[model samples]
Target: MCEACSSATRGFLAAGDCEGLTSLVEEVEFTSHWSYEDDSNNDSTNASNDSVRNRSMVETRVPRYWSWHQQSGEGSFVPSPDLNGWMLTIDAQNLSVGYHYRLCLDVDGVGTMQGYGYTGVKAFVSPVKATDVDLPLPRARDAELQLSCPLGPSGASAFLATSCDTTLPATTRVTSLGEVRTASVPVLSAGSASACSVMLDTAHLPGGRHFTLCVGVAGSGASLGMIGLPALGDALVKVYVTPISAFTSPRGHGVVLLGQNEKLFITCSRCTGSSEVFISSGACFVGLASANSSFKSTPTFASLLLGSSSQWEAVLDTSAMPAGQAYRLCVDLDGHIDSTLGPGDSGQFVRISGVLAVSATGLAASRVTVPLQCSGCSTSTAAYLSSSCSVGPLDVISGPLRDAPVSMALDGMGGFTVTPGISGLELFRHYDLCVDLDGIGTVSESFFSGHSVFLSGLLQVLGFSTVFKAPAQPISLSCSGCIDTSKAYLGLSCGGAGGFAAALGATAKAAPTTVIRTSGTSELLSVDAALLDAGKHYVLCWQQYEQCGPGMV
Candidate 1:
């Protein structure tokens, strides 16, 4: 038997945050303190051993005999190593979590029951789970991600590991740097053991790869420990690393031309964040390639949309940009995402070099440098077109795509060259090229004959890409004092010696063509538009003659 520590020491937490403890005790009224050597011989004053009864706490004694719910049961009352009080453990006891518990102690003395202490005050004991983890694990790359975690007293250091397969190892012990990916610096060690949040550096993580989160203390190996996640953890626990920035459309390199008021639609992937596009002076062959390279003081921000977790798209209105001048265009990520952590190494985006050739005087030799751009289209969709080559409204009667939808594939830059020669535009033809993108939108434009309409468009105005013949281009030549030759005309050819394609246009050389001119006053020739192949350089040739009879009279 043991003495009573206090007559009224109830209402105290019997055990704080107990673990692996189970018990079921009967609820009885607090009346008197009595101890018995035998239930039949209960004389409260003549109790057990006087030596042990004098001590309030008997460390050597293990309290085992007790009744639960007025029934016989076995349990133990021992000092707790983690808390400042005693903990209760029992066998053949039924208890559930989240339920408050109260335990009373009765000991076996002299081979019989002995009532020790009847605490007048009430007490409580709580069963708590050990450690836990939280979720909605965010996707990150080369940036700082704020997170919350429950890290009690023994503070821990957060660690990150990457995996392409998205499969975490069965065991949590990760020793190698390759396995752990990267880790260092303590986490949530700011104070005593507590439930707190922490920050994770999402750097040095490969893009498009899966990652695992972990925490450890005083250990070389970082163990994977996200244990408190909710059900359906498959979607919540899987974390991925995104690229800093990359060009998804217009490819990574090339030349893309744009007309005035036409937009250059760009799509990019940046794990860090968004960015603004700038039009620099002239096209830089080495954009962002050279650190010394500078950009225009002013920048033209494009209309951007975070299309998905992997890609974002933008469209720039070139109306503010000066026409006829080539400008370096590039997509940047550092401009948007916070890069406090080192961005590892690379994050190259889109860069193009090309001329903005707009002509009110018309292309020399009737050849226009056409720059075509397309957006909101899949990589396989295309466009069908037929034109008379005039930079005007689409001629539905002349367009072949009127009956059914057609598709075409544009170059990486969504550009097409318009010239008269091979890989060039046709002489003069009007076209209505149309594309029905992913069934979500349409992207199509027309550039038939004399009216050269090259579309550098986005979304509903754009589609896939393809190479087609150049639309027709009309030309008119003039001279104040010149000779009118009935055999004069216009022709095209690849860049070479004398190897020319046939002439295409209505001219003096054309059969039964009418020529309007006044000898020695003015000479004017109007050539009709004609279709030519796409993506070629053609040399223009003009045929004209004059007969100077013996006029020196």
Candidate 2:
């Protein structure tokens, strides 16, 4: 008795490399593995005669194809009764077929009959072994990687791992091994897709390492993995057939999208009156005169018919599109009808751009452009367009805009202003007196002597507390350092002669401050004021410094 198969033949191999598998030998002979041609070299004439006679003799000994002969003693070599033409057969009565014969052709063989009987009889079936066909595993990839196992009729589960070997952490998905795994389970709705609990985190596996997958019966309690066909492969691309009349919608009333960019434009001439179209995925929508167009009721917006020719041009911004991917184009019409309407005519239809090929993934435009129109199938009861508005490119204002005054100053100190008048001058002098300054320009304490002075309380200024409330921080002055150095410095000064002086001195002591004196001109400035502490305020005054040259400065 011979055990035809053992566990050794079932051992797995790393994907892509099948090194030790056996090959099938079809013809069998128990003779010297040599030819008579060798002896011919020694004697030409003799060898030729010998060869012809030997060939004739060999042909006579060999029976016609499929002929049978007796074994050594009483046993016979009869063809198999179950099949014919090179059929492996046996003839016996009450003879128990003890062991199975191992036949190796392309791969290791295992099927061996046990029970044997007379001709035209059945034999005991042998234990069937899983045939290990040489199936090349897919090459591992950096992105999505899939390993498949053919489970024949039985469904299987396969573990997807980062490593070629199955030892590491992996994900398992059930698949029919040999053929398509047709599932009668509940349909996988929009959001419910079975996912493998095992995660293939590339970070865990060493880069460039190879992995092997196990193909085992699902729920078989085996460590090996099962297999299934890809969900996104050929089977998934089934042509979903639907009757054209199923979409009975009105013509010209719908939304249109162009290009992969999915830029949706208005179909109605009255842009403002046109319903705000929210284009999504590959759907288009228009108006329909049905009472229930929403999937639920008998009448639905599905009745709207957006015709083929009527399309709103969609100018997609390709810069915003992804590269090299397929996009679906769909349309839908959300019905928002006025109560005054009855069963109507102005029908809306979802419009889709003609079938187009997006060469590149990112933002793309269509070669053939289309004009757009909408449904005006005005019904007596339905509210039709009384008036409409058209829109164009928006108008925008430019140039410098005036802003509220932020900070004002007269000289190098913190100060307040005096309106242009005699009393204003007196009031200014009074404030100056309180500040203990001589006059607006002098910075002496005498001019502020008679003014009503108040400490104003200590307040949090920029970064420090001060007796007087800090005036608004100085506005910044825009200046290009590359321009006339003198003019840029002048541009930075926030009014006071001392302020300009300090700025010019700090910027370039050698570059004189003669040019930036815009005393009379009402100038706007943005100051950094890093020179002043946050909350601190100082005594102030204003003085006429350098006057602008005659007409302008």
Candidate 3:
């Protein structure tokens, strides 16, 4: 065998990192070499080579043998002749039984067992026990069976239980099998099995259920027996019966399951993630149409819940409402939910409930609008303003007239008329038609029951009279005399002694009086009463400047 080429030699030769030479074998006293030769004396070899032509070869009795092991001190010997480098046992042998971490093989000086050089080392991993085996049985029935004993390394017996099913418990037994001690299963009944599986009766499990097989081997001849898991596996058996009904909410839908005869209402204020619009009074329900089926229905109000993925649900009791007949289902995804219908849109009123069924064969459809009313007013007006014309005839003809007052007269003799009447003669008298002097002045008037007039330039509407065919001009009226009923003027007028005066119009002046003061701290001040008239409408305003605090009140 080659000195460094032999696997055994190389395995031991690489005691250190380098393979050229090393002294670790001498230090550790570990052998790292081996050799072999043809042994013709062996009965089996002699018989096989008996047909050799030469009688000397057939009768050869010379026994050739070679040996290789770590050599310390002494003289070095050359490799045996007629031998080629071959891997030989160095780290381990069948006779030797012990644990070793790192073992390398070197055959002569050429072969290597590991990456470096052959160490002639083969790994023998220890065996561990797997899960126990068990026979399947119905949850409600009594079960008993025999199991094989467990084993460990060195073929020793071990103690174990039949607790293969996670949902159940187990018991074990010990017995003696001739010279070797063995284990047997203890007697088990239905009561023991019931404790393992709660709520499971024999009636429920018509077929046997699956179970992991297990075994025990305590107090046996061997400490434990080795467990050899087979490649093939057996199919499991099961037995089942009718089951009870159950309820569960679908994931991520914000839903809940309810029992029979039960009712639920969901009020989600604003739509959340993935939701677009959120109206107040958003509500939803489920299974409202059918008693047995589950579902969510719409609320009666007009309020709607808006969102991209926003959703809600209502659970119902199975006992309360069953399947079949159509029920109420009203959904307002965008508008306010109201309780009733009225004359106009109230915004507050929305339909919360409506009929819903699988078939649309026979069903009535109706619609309703809610009533509207101002908060502080005594009488509410539901009338719709159809048409209004308030623009100077010149302005209407000259410009687009988009900014013209709707109720103001557009002609020089006309004023603003809010109500557009059917007749032309009636519209001219009631509304003073005139053109505005400039675009600065604003004239507002409303005729809910009369005709409208047009205007163009700067002018004023003096006043109207019940009997006169024409109104009085500013020069024809007397400011100092008693009030006259025969005529009314719509023009500019004087206020005091030398103030400017013009044609009298709808605007009225206050009666003049001298300035004076009252004696008491709290006195009633008379507002100009002349500014108000019997048949005309006006805006009256007053302000109170308090010099003191609550004490004054």
Candidate 4:
């Protein structure tokens, strides 16, 4: 093997220089060497001696010269004069593998520099090598163990061995030579050629025990001196059991209103050990719907385990209990009664009431009757009328007339009716009538209607002149057939010619006068005399839309 002087040695060489020719001679002689051999055969050896003697005579006569020298065969030397350093190269073909070598350099006046000595300087051919091992931490249900091993030049095979002892047999050994084992570990080239891995099925190993793993190689076992697998004392070989961590269904807590044949779902964290789930209502675990003398008979319900061990379902029939009543529910693990569910109310039952139909009598000139029908309501509950169902003051209908007293009445059954007077009510106006059996807090629905104005009798002018002089002041006119005093008005046309043409044409030419409204069957119209002309005959008429009373002139 070849070697070069380290930087520290080169620094010493560069700082120290030969002073004179004598120093140069010393340095050159220090780097040179000679070899001699003895010949045993006499006849041919004498001939070689004669040739050697002749060569010696020529060498002695010539002047001797000295310079930096290098050994022949398997090595070379290159000098860097500027750097005062030299490098040596050696052909390693003839060297044996796994052996260390040391090189020494002698410089005149600089002492000797050596490599691979007791100072930890050395190089070896074909050093033993291996890849990192990836052993898995044993688990309860794990079915297989996978790992990787080093591949060698000649290829390799691998195996997995298990032992119950804390420490397995020695992974490495020597033939009195402390070199590592030259075993070739198997390579899994189908996946990665450089990195070989192996998978071992561990189903045969018993659970809940400690085990050690030993990895070994074949093919190049003798070349690699020793093997050391990773520590396996911490490996656990037991079966895995999933634990029940928490509950998921029925939420944290609240009331669950279960109707007839309605299913209640219960969920929990997955667990494989136990498959049974149990449900109970009273103190002890009683059959679903078991009869109790103190309380009402509990309804028999059906339960089923759904999907995996995480969920269960129970359905309620509710046929034994009356509607509108409340019940409490409780739950627990199948056999673990001490482990109660989360805090707060576990469950409850609530019956809902509904309105079937709501009707009202036709809104008439005098009154309106609202009739309501509902389910799950008592005879004492009366219906109320309001614009909205929001809890607040209600606009309830009262007494006989539009301005009468306010009251409500219900029949013995769920039906009820309220007749409120419409005397003061505005005709042809829509009203939203909302009825609640138990007021806004309970059940209710809304109805709508518009008050209709009826012309019961013919429109008649009670007091008017067929012909009259224009009055100095407005005249008081009256009518008897108007629907109501508030909705009725009167008009007159005067200061025109006589005859039906004059009467019909006069109305078109004159603007009608409005009359003050009053609360009675008859309305009095006051005509403005200033709107009339003197010495003119006029025709008077009573009109509610196109229905006009017999024209008066």
Q: What's the lDDT for all of these models? A: 0.32, 0.22, 0.23, 0.32
Name the runs in model 2 displaced over 4 angstroms.
1-197, 208-215, 218-553
Deviation in Å, model 1, residue 116 alpha carbon:
42
Report the error of model 1 at residue 430, Å.
14
Query: Candidate 4 residues 165-266, lDDT tens each?
Result: 223322232111111111223324434433334333333432212233333222222222111121112122211211222233331111122234534554
For residues 57-134, write the lDDT of model 3, one tens digit per residue.
Answer: 223234342212221111122344325534333332221111111234333334344344334432221122222222
Q: Which ten residues in a row have the lowest lDDT in candidate 3?
A: 544-553
Count backbone overlaps in model 3: 148
What digit string (tens of lDDT, one per residue) describes model 2 on residues 232-349?
1111111111111112112111322223343333332211222223222222222321222221111222211255332343333222222111222222222245322112111122
lDDT for each residue of candidate 1 in 1-553, tens digit (9 for 90 to 100): 1243222221111221222223434432234444433332444555565434443532333443322332113354555554456544443124222112334454331223344332433221112112222222233432443343332413344445543112232223343364236543344433444434445555445443445554433322222111111110011223334343444333112223332333344443443333444445433212332333333313334455545554444454343332222344433344423333211212222222222332211222223233344333344333333333222222332232233233333446645332222122231122233322232232222322112232110111012222134222322334322234432233232111111122332222222123456444333334332344345433223322221110000
What TM-score would every model get versus the actual structure? 0.22, 0.14, 0.13, 0.19
The residue ranges of model 1 lying beyond 4 angstroms of the native Cα positions read: 1-200, 206-209, 213-236, 240-434, 437-553
